[model samples]
Target: MTLRRLMTACVIAAGIAGSASMVASPARAQSAMEAEIIGFHQLCEKGDRKACIRFGILIGRNEQRNADWRRAHADWFWFER
Candidate 1:
């Protein structure tokens, strides 16, 4: 594959790796998925720019979810009043 195509595939795979834990059922399944994510994350740490960018996107997504949940729960208090 060309460089552009390779980067796109790696980015897509990184996203899937990020979400793998969410849908994983068994402990073994989760372990395997987590290992895949770790591998990607390690690549990011090693200065692979594309991998680093994808990893940052994954982390940002998690933070966004946490912020959304916190906002929703905080709003619950107002709803009760």
Candidate 2:
């Protein structure tokens, strides 16, 4: 009800909103990355040697990124063998 209280509440609300946006930003970036990875995947499947290398580098480090890499690997064993 007081001006001081109102300003404190506003600051809290702004902090919460800012944090939520920060959390959301990574998900957006990840989806964009996934899209790029998918495009590379398609290219790799179609016999683009350079694309295959790029795809592996982008999604071959950890288990999370490796999920896509595994799928692509299975689908493109011809290239591997």
Alpha-carbon deviation at 20 in model 2, angstroms: 24
- Candidate 2: tens digits of C-alpha lDDT, residues 12-75: 9999999998887764344787788889989987999999999878876667657655675576
After superposition, which runs of candidate 1 have C-alpha atoms over 4 Å from their true positions?
1-33, 64-81
Q: Would you estimate the TM-scores of all the predictions? A: 0.34, 0.44
Alpha carbon lDDT at 25, candidate 2: 75
Q: What local lDDT score does residue 51 receive in model 1, on the 0 to 100 scale?
A: 79
Total backbone collisions for each predicted model: 0, 0
lDDT of each: 0.64, 0.78
Measured by TM-score, how close is model 2 to the native structure? Answer: 0.44
The C-alpha RMSD of each candidate to the native structure, in angstroms, is 19.9, 6.9
lDDT of 1 at 11: 100
**lDDT tens digits, residue span 1-81, model 1:** 599999999999999987896677554544563455456678976889887776555545676644554465465225535
Pick by TM-score: which candidate is best? 2
